[model samples]
Target chain A: MKRTASPSFAIYTPDSSLRQPLRLVGAMFRDLSSGRELAWRLAVRDISAQYRQAALGLLWAFALPVANALIWLFANASGVVLIRDTEMPYPNYVFTGTMLWAIFLEAANAPLQLTTAAKPMLAKINFPREAIIVSGIYQTLFNAAIKVVVLLPALLFLGVQPSGYLFLLPVAVMTLVFAGTAVGLFLTPVGLLYTDIGKTFPLAMQFMMYLTPVVFPIPAQGIAATIFRINPVTPLIQTARAWLTGSLGTDLVAFGLVNLGTVLVLFLMWVIYRAAMPILIEKMSAS
Target chain B: MSDPLIKVENVSKKFCRSLKRSLWYGMQDLGSELLGRRHGDNSQLRTDEFWAVRDVNFELGRGECLGLIGRNGAGKTTLLRMLNGLIKPDTGRIEMRGRVGALIALGAGFNPVLTGRENVYINAAVLGLTKAETGRHFDEIVAFAELEAAIDSPVQTYSSGMTVRLGFAIATTLQPEILILDEVLAVGDANFRHKCYHRINKLMTDAAVILVSHNMDAIAQTASSLALMDGGAMTVFHEPVEGIAAYHDANAQRQATTSDGGTTHQCYAPVVAAEVRILPAEVGYQGQLTVEAEITCDADLPEILISFTATNAYEQAVMCWHSSRHPSPLGLCKGRQLLRFSVAPLLLDNGSYHWNFKITRRGSLEHVVWLTRHGPLVVKSRHRTLGNIPYLPDASQCEHRMLTSP
Candidate 1:
């Protein structure tokens, strides 16, 4: 067959046909987003996979929040600690923050976690990248959900009294859940902009773990505390603790509102990520 | 600047890579030093220096198979990466008008944890095969790769050869408008490589193929025209045959130019090692070449037996000749040694062939002091074209074998 090059020239014009490609891209994402059910299943699979390969198994999961709480208990038992002497035992205070923000961020980080680790999978395989992220996040959520449900009775036995504010804790937790998820959503797409974001994530988490009240309380309105609250997660952490220990009072509403505001920020990022995903992956795939 | 399906105008790329830490604690020491800001430590962006592919330009028309030829570190891969848009050029622009599919590095996109099937789907999609298109061609791909049994298994379990084979299968199945194959065919056995190149050649219905490979014969056979790339520049652009010749010449000259040119003709040794040709016997025309060698040296020279061997384009030997000890009285010193054997040049049908020579000490052919491959001896045939003869049975076998006596 005689194959010849199409030789021609013309002025550039707006290509409506280009829009057809966007439609295709949209269809692809729809196909991707359509896998919500699959996403959940993959998350469960990931959770099982992590815990399955360990001799300690799921004990480690329980151990993480509980042991973390016991350390606070021991530290407070020394009475050198500040917030516990004010009233609440240190474990309950720490557990409240850990339950609300720590668990959620930890779960959210899952989706973005091996984002670098699963990089080989992303580069080499055909699975949905977002699905992998969502799966990991979901697995984290499952872990968090189990930890909290199991901790509720112990929480009361530990001399932590429950008031109506404890009911508001779920709302506080959901807000943080979506807020942390939005961070994950933002991280994956922006990560395409820089090569080292994945490497620095755990470090960023270390800073956040300290900045938020997972271990100690930072009273509201101090200058240093405000800097720590710079992460929208701080308020959510404080809110979760307050609700569980009946200390939320009026700030719980404000914390939920801030989380909702962060969601809008995520919405904007979601748009940018959607725009950049194909182009980024395309650049990565070239020989 | 003119309208080409792919316009590569002064396009070049350089990557900034931190040298891999050769020792443990290398990064830790560096980090601590940097954080401490030790006195007189001139850490002046040593990590950020540039390794560049300079300005290179080439354009591809539709249905064009442009060969890219170069020595190692000659910027051919850098140029290919630019065209494929894998990495952006450090300077200049590469403008293309259609979907570009690059099988740049084989299995560069395959995920080992995923099943072969899942990889096929996503890999195809990334390679510009849409979801539906990937689904449609999936079976043909599996069949071609001959991996039906293991399609559902994770690719990590596969051998490197199998991974490459499956990759080539998937990439070629696209039959893309523009197919960028970068040394991908180097994988697999010779028989399979032939099948792959043949399949790829047949797929030139309307596809523009840009092939980068180390095999000149392959480039000559598969590509329409060749583009020779050197240190960040286009050296020669021509038809495949001529390109192959120029490449050989350039490489020979490169070795010659870079070396201490003491033996003015030491550079010419490989080219002029032997006078060889193949021509037809009819009408005073020698069409096929039969190479016979003669070894003449001083009697004082170590007693040696000279053997001659012939290899076809595939590097397979078709014929060989060995010369026994020369009569000691012939005065081996300062005399022309002629080891002459002739073929009617009938068996070597077509394509390039290399003549290999071996010189060994007396009584031991294994003591090879000299070995060389005479590259690119083309056998021009007129009357017949025999494609890859496997066995040469005796001609008498076909004539009434039933009455044969032991």
Candidate 2:
């Protein structure tokens, strides 16, 4: 339904209404549709700036994760960390899993990185601030596309044929992004105030990867398996892998609940972000 | 008319000096917003916090300009930010009818690593332009900045003037209905600054402009109304001249109270009656400016310097005269002293001006009495001047000047 603002002009204050969640959702939809060109421009700026004067440029995007997956593969093969057998080749399995994890990581980092980078602009210009987030997501997706270029070729070389459930890959990726960004949006305000979160996020994410079954199969009965079950990202990563291979996961209920929880939590995060952004911006600029 | 295009009502903003307390307060504010609680009174400031802008009320109609002038941290920039929607006020509201274009800082959104051409696109987008819109005006923007040769070069390589030119060009392209300009003339060369003033004058016919500048001349030339801000409070003057006078008075008072010599030393102000008169009615005919003052001092004083500064209507210095420049030392004594001064063959064109008078210690910078905008002097013009500027030089001097004399 098309919604019209009762008052065309807006009055803003530090203590203004958060607006109804429904109204915020409506505004987000409006900005996404109308401000698409601006978002595209901002994304293009980031991509061009990121690649300019660089020797390797965009290749570094895929190269980093490829190196990461290779380390785990070598560890398992050397019997340093024994891995459970999988239906697909271990290299292809690890590659896709690590590549998907990278996407989540980028999505999780987008809010803080984009907001920090745009601080000066935000303090002076008054455009739709949400364009920053939209542009950030677009940049993250572009980076993921670079990773897919290598991931696709690796899958083909490993002779892993595409499965019917491969069509669900986009949905699975969406769930991962939504879940990751939900936590990111919730923490963005805190990160804006304290630099510690931004400084330690990469290290924290590295440790978090071990708790999820990214390279190895989930053990049936062990402390590792219990951690995997409890971890919020487990269902997302497992389901994405199941879709990539022909084998579907055993627990459909867990997948549904995780997806549902992700959507709810993401909506809540959007509410918090909308309410806190102005206050955060005012404080950040003053300091 | 038709309700003002911009209305700022009792707007206030508070700022905290401590980062930790600011963050905590922000979180608490956010929680209150989520819970739909009423905002507490913002006029009362807590420790480590102060109101950046308080109870600022004003309105602007279409085609009107409001000039904001204040010392640093008086909340002029903060008020502009609120009007531009970059920051929300802590109390009251700012309502406006159309798009707001702000050039609050030069090169504010430009990426240093990006070429000027690329930065133009991003900055236009940041100012609310679509990709196609920016593309359509791309050539014009570059032309306006006069940076066609350097368009492909990285912005970091550009000089500060070049950066400001490009930023101004991009920001003004939208011709927004409500434009907020903050200290844009603080950079750029004289020629470009004049061009900017001309361009802004063109935009003034249809837009409501909120201008914050330290250049008194810029304010007086462009603004129909003026606001004087101090300590987070604002007083608006509908008449441009009155506003300028109030600004000068406040500024003089502030200087008197804060200057080390003025505040620390014991001194007395000699009462004086001052008046300024222009001779021959019109300029360009060897007109003269005369100033007369009757000074009465309680006790005899030696070695006092009496100085006069002539400022144009915009409060820019046109000329200065000092008794100390003479071979004989000017002195003050008990009872009354009558002083008369005249500058014959005044070079000023037809204009209204304010005369600033100062009495200081002969050898030191210490001001005994500083009277700002003491009186008005009016000079009429019978014939047009040689050039656009008010200063007029002798015809023989202008005519005899050789093209390659150097």
Candidate 3:
């Protein structure tokens, strides 16, 4: 039989009805509002469940990054890796940098974590899937909230003066979040299909961190320095570091350009997610 | 009837057999969507792929209950998933006007580390309930699940039955406009199943329900109308009983045609053909079975063993009788001959059974022919209300026995 539809009922098919780009953009705004409440609920669910069985509970959120920071501090002190000199105490610098990077890591990992946890629901339930994405991000931010507790005290202990452009820190941190999440959202469809993406992503992120100015300042000159300069994330990380330590870098223009590029990439990825998520969910579940 | 709350029109879905091709197809589908290109003809079967659901059509109006009865791989789950909007139809459309809640997989959304109460709230929100709504109904849900004491415990600590009870309670209490249940009732105990049926009946007063289950009695009891699904296509029946009977008929056909593979023993004798027919279509408890067979042989045979084996619903052989085991043996004529045998009442269980008829040479591996699945025998129970009563219990027939006196 041929396709048939009544005026009262909306039809669904493998082929999505062609919608204008403007309509899709409008739908995203509408979806965000509708999905926000559920996202908060899911975030609460995730946070409670994450620590329900653990003895240390939410402390692990702070503990994990602090532990990594200490390991790096010792390595630099013993001259194991020889991180470049900085004006601030190296431990505090490493801790602050780690904190910012942790937020970026959370944002980058949000899409994969959300889709994996929601796979069963995706197969059976038909609720707003955007809620999963929003919840994942909210959970990331919630974990980062605990990091702020340590951050304020560490800055005081290190005796570092605040930058006059300290208010711009939010803008810098947001750029890191957006850039990381844009890359993650772009990988979500691929990750759901080929689990190789999930297994290899953490290793890839670890490698990319070396290219960014996460643990050390960008080198002055060398092949590695050139690679770091070309890296988009280097400006974002350095900008946040510069804002936190009261040392404004000369790469403010590059940082602004990177933020602008991150926004555009995020918008493109959001559009791709809207178009591709349902198809990916369907295929993943059926397989 | 008022306009259907859920309208499903000629919905079809395709699935690939190989994992590699399935992933490739997924990528291609996603690429097409990004490019705003229409999907290619999915109705045309590709290599290593077939339609899981094909040209299925149905409508569910408010206050209506529709039952989907089929065997495994019959596409009922696929159809329900499409209606729930978990997936889109490959060829057609499914449109619903109201919020749809599906219990396609029980405990599917539960997080093991979350408390039962917490899981219920999240599950309610997943079904579109707000936080305030979930809070308002939290006690009611826990009460319905009878998990008051254990509601605070992590879901991982609860048994499978408790998990399903919680899942069911949340879905039903949410009072969705359209409810889709798929084999969920099979997991819980009898008491919970009864409660579920009661809740579903109450839900159908306002919302439409689509139920897919293997239990014929449940379908017959609950469905306002029924749909039979076989090999992906759907045929709706006006009467639930008729739909159930058609399901059994289709199952019988499926049973008879399934390949048994190459035979280990072959008959050297030249045999033309064989036919078997049951004397009566329906047999009651302790009723005589008269099996008639007509076999044509090229040469006269000394004695041919005519045997029939009756197997229960579980495919367990309940009875085996052969002409050679009889007190007096019989011989077949040279040409076509009709033979009839009257045996004692089988006294087997009261359920559907398959009677397999076979012809073989006496005391030899050589065989004439074999009909693996001859036909179904609907055996009636002495207790008219009971179905599938295996054997008469060895208990005393007395209604009451005094074990102790005050």
Candidate 4:
């Protein structure tokens, strides 16, 4: 009786959907809500399938950040390059930085990764497109959780004291995730269309890491310091590391402003993604 | 009549021939959408662009199955995609009232490393079913797929047919009010196919269905009305018989132009020239028919086998005659050879037909020299028959007897 009384109805037209802003936003929210269960199922499926065959399993998630930390420690110890004195031990500082950066990188890459993996289904099934985005977030959060589990113990073992500020670590880590996801979501439409984006994304992220105080402390006064201060990633990562190490020099104001900006930009990118999906799917299916 | 559940109005979508151009155009279109600008006159095509589905219109009420019959690349899938809301049409509007379920790509998102049990839940979720709903249908889905024993095994271990069966089962379990199917019936074994059709028939009682399939029998059995698509355009036929006829005529015409005179195999003994002639160019039902073929050979051959297949107007092979099965064997020398084949009392119903001839070496099934799609062999009959081959016995062979009532 309910099904007959209120059968779902949908209309698709060539007219610009942006012309109907209210409807567009309404549909977006509706799909996002309806897509949650599907997104969770997909995330579970992907996470299980990903590590099932890999002998390394969850170690693969830890592999990247740990290896990066090891590489930087080796470089710092061998005096291969001059480094600024960190407020915390170099090992602890770089370890926390790389761990946080890995979370950011995973968040940044999740949108495109999940989307590309689901391209076949995207072209064929008429499911809520937002499910892919939500699935990406689920996976990102899952991976971030794993990295945090590894980080907390490793940080304490490395002589860093957990402080009262530790309660804010999740907020800081989420802000970084939000910022990274915003950038990734913004690029998803074009990235889906072109191979060049996927190919060059890693190199671009690596270059950005050097500017974000991931491998080295921010230069006291120089062109590098100017760049680091100007980089939006700086405050987010620095605050997350400070929260973990109980440091007093956290830029809370800049971090909050960056978080606010990330929210606005993420929403804007989501709208763009929603609008561009049909065209992208058509192009993808056609080719 | 019930209110129409699906209505499509003058929908058209353009695609670029070159991938580069298509991506570039996609970027431009995305920019316009982002800027809130109207998609600049969709009627006009840019360079390297052409309309994939042009000006298609249709409406389907509940309980109606609209069969889409067309050659490959005839925009049937494109139109279906638009109706499924997977992609937007560049030019018109599509209104779908009620939940839309698509079997366009069964098992589309199946992860091979996951077990069939897991994949079913994922697939059902993708079709818009909740986890609890999938759980409720889990046993039925597995039973329908006949994979109860292997359902726990990883999908990678299952055969392709098993996977398809699982996909079909999960997709159909949703029972949405609008179903979009694209060539899904072409898979699975005959028994499973029968089950799929039976399920679809049940689903059709309360749903609007759009089925795109090349299988004519399936179309005729399922569709209430048929839409024949050609060159991105459509002609609707309320009568399935007329639509199938038009489809066959179109097929015959296209085959005539593009036969390529059969693909000539460059074997050691190649057929240089070949000609086939019927004893009587015009054949009548239940008449003795004789066929003669002259094949010129380039080299001497020890033993050759010739086979003849006669296909009716619907492209269904009605009769087959092979030479190797006969008592005598024929050989070819380094010259033109005349091969004669005769059939007595042809039982084919009145219709136009084509003959396909194949010449192969003895002991080998591969065609050494093949001449295909040779004729419009017209057969006429005094009394009309119902099916392809009429059961007409010769008068001398027929006997009538009167029995006492018991």
Residue by residue across B1-406, what tens digits does model 4's lDDT show? 8779999898888878998888899899988888887653548999998888888988999989999999888888888888877788888889999988777788877999999999998998888888888888899999999999999999999999999999988888877788887776645999888998888777667889898887787788889999999988889999988999999878767756774633333333466777778878678887878988777878778788877888876567888888868887788888887888787778777777787777888887777766666776777876665656655755676667878766
By lDDT, the better pick of 1 and 2 is 2
Q: Rank the candidates by lDDT, best first.
A: 4, 3, 2, 1
Cα lDDT tens digits for candidate 1, B57-148: 66677778888887887777656655554333445666766555566545544666677887776556434455566777889889888899
Candidate 3 local Cα displacement, residue A25, angstroms: 3.3
Point out where model 1 deviates above 4 Å.
A1-63, A74-92, A99-204, A219-231, A240-249, A252-287, B1-4, B14-52, B108-140, B152-154, B173-175, B190-195, B198-203, B235-238, B260-406
For model 3, what is the error of residue B61's alpha carbon versus the real structure, in angstroms, after optimal superposition?
2.3
For model 3, residues A121-198, the per-residue Cα lDDT tens digits are 777776667787888777777777677666767886788786686777777777777787888898998888889999
Q: Extract clashing residue pairs from model 4.
A: none
Which candidate gets the maximum TM-score versus the true structure? 4
Of 3 and 4, the candidate ahead on lDDT is: 4
Off by over 4 Å in 4: A1-7, B40-42, B252-268, B328-331, B362-365, B387-389, B392-406
Candidate 1's DockQ: 0.08
Rank by TM-score, descending? 4, 2, 3, 1
Alpha carbon lDDT at B320, candidate 1: 64
Tens digits of per-residue lDDT, candidate 2, B212-319, equal 888776788889999999999999999976887887778757656774412222235553433333343344435776667666777766888887776874557777
Q: Which ranges of candidate 3 are over 4 A from the true structure?
A: A1-10, A85-89, A163-167, A247-249, B259-406
Q: What value does the lDDT take at residue B101 in candidate 2?
A: 62
The ten-residue window of minimal lDDT in model 4 chain A covers: A1-10
lDDT of 2 at B220: 80
As a TM-score, model 3 comes out at 0.79
Better of 2 and 3 by DockQ: 3
Docking class of 3: acceptable
What local lDDT score does residue A208 receive in model 3, on the 0 to 100 scale? 84
